[model samples]
Target: MLLLFAVIALILNEAVAWSPTNSYAPGNVSCADDVNLVREASGLSANETAWLKKRDAYTKDALKSFLDRATENFTNSSFVDALWNSGKTPKLGVGCSGGGYRAMLSGAGMLSALDNRTSGADKHGLGGVLQSATYLAGLSGGNWLVGSLAWNNWTSVQDVIDNRGQDDELWDISNSILNPGGINIFSSASRWDQISDAVEAKQHAGFNTSLTDIWGRALSYNFFPTLYRGGEAYTWSTLRDADVFKNAEMPFPISVADGRYPGTEIIDLNSTLFEFNPFEMGSWDPSLNAFTDVKYLGTNVTNGTPVAKGQCVAGFDNTGFIMGTSSTLFNQFLLQLNTTSLSSFLKGIVEDFLDDLSDEYDDIAIYNPNPFRDTEFVASNYSHSVVDSSNLFLVDGGEDGENIPFVPLLQEDRDLDVIFALDNSADTEDYWPAGLSLIATYERQFGPQGKDFAFPYVPDVDTFVQHGLNSKPTFFGCEASNMTDLTRTPPLIVYMPNNRQSYNSNTSTFKMSYDSAQRMQMFQNGFEAVTRNNLTDDSGFAGCVACAIMKRKQESLNMTLPSECTQCFQDYCWDGKTASSSANVSTLGPASGSVSFVTDSATSTSSSSKKNGEPQMPQSHSMSWYVVFTTVLGVALGIM
Candidate 1:
């Protein structure tokens, strides 16, 4: 009886193992069940409950859409084959017990395709969808539990449906199946805990914690439905190994100072922390270096004796035109100078000029003399180098020598008319804008009223096309010339009188002349007015006092007088004759002439007529003289 019972027991055990019921029976709890337990324990609020309800509805709709798509594309034969083949080995595919497992696997594949399409459409919207799904899955643990039970019987079928979604249970269960080692459900708290731990570890190590890490861990543990769905993993390891990131992070040495400090630092000052040393040292001290030599205090020290506050030998003016002084301390020093002594000096000059001009003139004209001309035309030389220096007339060369000079032309009339032309040629773009900006600044600063003279030609075709009317008297047009071109048709020849006085010369000939002493006085006055003018800051004026002064010198040769006037104007004028007279005589004839008489005289004085009218040719006269001389000599010899 005992032997029979043992045999029966063995047969029963074998039958149970072979039966499909045992293989597919619910053994492990699912991710969905886990989430339900969490929700129940947490207790959802009214708003949370409503959100959950909506999320569930969306999840059902999405799942149904996935199912419909899957059914349409499904082949039961293919699923059966995949399942049967996969069952023979732990290979990839649906299993032979093709019921819920086959259906779920096919459904998962369909969902995956849908998710891909949706995610690609809009990442944010997909994220919202996933979030909603996760919430719904968490709420409905029963669905996930059932799915998990079905999944165990045919793991291959489970693998197909796994994808990234908000439904914690579905995602977790899918992730498990995709990964194979982790828990079977998407809503498992243990999986989240593991992810949180990994994040904490990265944070502790000073590594950047990103969402990618969480997804990677989840995928590793079979929490994600589709193994490749989350996107490529990005971690510190990847960044450190990649060519681009490695190059970006690589250390490079940079120089801090000139020969005074012969050292290099690994950190780039532009990117990393850098500071200028308040203390000064005359020579390079390698021993005092920190980064290159010894890991000393945060600061670098000099081995040589410390430099006294102001006793350090100064470098020659190695200042760049745009970059300014080299030493980091120089700007601070300049700021201090501007605040104290320089401010006072400027203030005094301005006060003196305003005081001088207050009674004599209502408003002062800020003139920029064109350096290219004989007269100091204040409007032209505003930003030239010669006028920017301390020697205003640029008179270092010596008296009677060509020295670039800046002289201010004072106008009694506050209302001014300005002809502004911008050279729009490729090379002139930079210089032209600077010049125009300066002019605009000047006009705003000194003159309350001004009108720009119009030019007929535009230097740039593009500008002409855009602006239409070429004669429009605004900041427009440019032309290449031997020297700077003036825009006015007749050339702006406004006779600015110091006081109301009638001159005998013609309108064009009546030039405004200021003596050396008078010019100096006016320059001093103008300088003061510019430095002190409240209008300097208003109306978009950049307060370029130095530039304004330079312009004045370039415009007027008068400024060079008593200094470089004679030499500067020598080329401009012939034998001290003004340019106007010389040009008039050479090209336009005398100031006054009758057209009929001039034309007749020109016709009468033709070269052909003059030659024809000659009494005898020079060659004929020379030949006759030679013959006569020879004959005379022969006669004299015969007589002798």
Candidate 2:
């Protein structure tokens, strides 16, 4: 072991010296406003609207295949035929929540169950849902799932899992980010140096770099699978050219973050939420009330106008940087460096980096040359507060408890028929979701900031647990007619909260790593949560999903609902009842045991360690090292 360690150390030292330097790649630019997708206050972008038309056509075909297989044994094909013949297509959006790797893998598992491409998923699966959907949104760790898939041309979650190597590089926990994963084949020194160099390059380019820059760069090795540590030249807009995305063969991906400044408290419903899509970056909130072309984000734009008539910046929206922006929460991961058992040399590197962060400097994504600066295009009261600032800082989307990325899906123009919200939030002590994200969104629809939007009624979080709503799949907005007082009809919401049936998948949000076995267990538990252990109940879970998708459309067409759908609504819809107290509320309760996975074959695994209890970490840390590291690194990184 000593010899192995020394050899690895030497290789790392040599690799660091040879770390690659990244260069800026210019994006296609035009003088026209539409070229940059300059935000219009009226509605959805022309680009998005245009893309949706193509996406709708694609969804129709994908849905035809999915519904045909999903309802194979049904007595009639009239429903499928009607959808095909009718010009109107059902619109679907998936919203995933934030919970570090726990949320990412759980979201993947749910998507796996819905994916038609997964082996053996056709019969009982909500197959083709992803391909049929027009929009997919993710927040925090969930962004990692969306970013990775988008960056990889919409690769299926199974493909990601299948690509795991002998060292378990796909989701390897043994190789810490500080130490660097072996998948890169870079020694520890090389890994650290390469990441440092990448961030330094961005800094040298006159952009402010923070811990998030470093964190995002590190995450690319595991999530992006590119040759460069940061995938430097890759921009989020590049997805527009990928065959799957350009051809509308897959869902449009959106990543979300919240507008937050240092030391400011954000209310759950009022935060000015921002979204990053292929075409642009902006908010639906009245605050900024505009979007700048994502590719030109680093350009000096004031009051919705660029610094020069013919000049706009490029290379600012690096894929890793954008992913890092949505998930700024994990910047805290760097602060936990001393807790790990890393060597003093490595621990000192991380500690020195983090030591410079002042309390207010923590958990922020520093966007210098703020794109919305000096803007008088005030659509809301809060516009003035952010528009005048030279720096636009953002934090985790879930900081205000709206963990699920649902804002973009609620746009009036999207006219979605149904939204499948995958709640992997760790709201409860045991880390299981408690539906707080949905509640926050629901409450926001009626608030001043979200007055124009509509959301299905969701009960309080207490009611969520009291009625066991958080433990199983439940539907909201089953009857839109009943909400006639609202501004518009809201999509039916199918809420699937993470839970334990065969495995305790509620790993802590702070957990930095997991072995492949534990990782698979989390995925399996998520699959079971969504599919009810893949049981076939007379056409099974897919039938229920189909019912949810068809419910709004059927009602719009004035058609009588099918009996299967009626039964599904009754079984899965919230009854609007609230208990006097949640005292007897059942939960997965306290999770115990880190479920161990033993791989038997390429596609097979067995669970062996059923020991009950969350993994415990030692707390004998001497605070001296951590204090010194934080102060030094924070200053050195210019984060202070």
Candidate 3:
């Protein structure tokens, strides 16, 4: 153990190199003239719209490649050609819901299927949709997946697997974060010291701290190991600095969080939904219809500019903290703390940290220097409780019960055509999604809180189970002109729920550790869920996806619904029907998948595209890492 202490000291020396950079320093420079990054939530930001124009090239190319292959018999060749020439291409968004690691990995899989970069994804599934998409949204664990991909140079899920256990690589979750540095208590102790000291540094700087600070710092290890020393100083706003992000090569990513004020106990549909993107972060609701620069989060701001003259601050929007802000500290941390195998000192540290947070508001991500302080957006009367507060408090994006990150994409000004929603929610008792998210979203649209944002009408959980909407892909908002009491057509929603299509991917949301095989299996299973078994024989399914994507513009242009779309709609679109009886326990997909993948007549693919057939597994991480490096991390610092 003495020799191990020496080894730990060496590792600590290496970690010292990552010690908190001056991310939260008082830069003496005056704020930029236009650094008044806050904008009214009337439409998409100019930065985002401009980026979309730049992204048009990539989206069009991706769509053309995908549609050319999938549109074989579904649409005539002439119509397909007209798609690009007429600029009638659809705008797509992808929303991955919360379910902790289950949501993270399963959402990763579903995206793997849509991602054209995945080998043979286009041939066997809806591969190119990811590239064609304009936005990618996530909440809670789903935010972890999306944020991890977006921050790490827009890496692929396969890349995460390929680089497992390598120094500074992400997704090495074999050891619970509670025990990050192997089972050696001394090593874990060393890590804890680093984490505690980092938090202390922030507090010593006069910022408020919470368990979320410690929680986010700990999470940075698995999502970004280079920061495992508890100095996750990288900011989410730095995404704009990435080469691919600057080039607009990938979909713009957004993570969602719900605002909670002092004394607010429960998050409801009316809770203001805040979105954090690279360019800005704020809520679209009239209550706080304004955004502020995401990079300068810690600086005291009034209206739109800094409160302190000529003093701008940086580094408050730490990447992991933003992810933690969206997830909150409850689901991932408290559920594990107070359990066995923890040192008394460690428990004392956590207990002290918990005691410092706002009374009764423990499930929060603290953001000092609230930019919305006295913010005056379009309607001054509707400003929320946070507008005057010195600090803003946020909780899990799904705490309102809308687990899927849909509110941001639903912004009317964004004018989205369709959203491919991957619902990996653990709404059901057994952990599978049961459509509660959609139901909440649907009902919320009619409430005053909805701000007139339109969404499709949805049935209850019973109907979802009876109709097996959870079992397979389902399209809502199909009734475009047919929708009742709507001012105009809303974006169509293509919801893909996680099911046991190939593997039982419904791992518990709080089950923090994942072996390489479990991770890979979940990834593959999510891929298969969206791609469908023998999807090669099911081209209509892809065509149906295309039809949903095209539906909005197609209606606007008065283009006739193609004969192919008629059948496509019949097979997948959900009509406004409710089940009279209560739902029984629902089990979905083939638990024991069969080799003979049955397909409808619409499934079609050429022989050449079938070469690299089914989704293949990536090289797995060695089990030896379990004993070699169980990297657990913990600490929080703030002066609130």
Candidate closest to the true structure, highest TM-score: 3
User: Model 2, 571-608: lDDT tens per residue?
Assistant: 88887665443432112122222321110000100111
Please give the lDDT score for candidate 2: 0.69
Question: For each predicted model, how many residue pairs clash, with residues at least 3 apart or on different chains?
Answer: 53, 17, 18
Model 2 deviation from native, Cα RMSD in Å: 9.6
lDDT of 3 by residue, 83-118 (tens): 667777788899999877788988998998998778
Clash number for candidate 3: 18
Q: Which of candidates 2 and 3 reaches a greater lDDT?
A: 3
Question: Candidate 1: what lDDT?
Answer: 0.20
Residue 285 CA error for candidate 1 (Å)? 50
| Candidate 1 regions with alpha-carbon error over 4 angstroms | 1-192, 210-640
Question: Which lDDT tens digits does candidate 1 get at residues 222-280?
Answer: 32232112111111111123342223211110111211111111111011111111111
> Per TM-score, what order, best first?
3, 2, 1
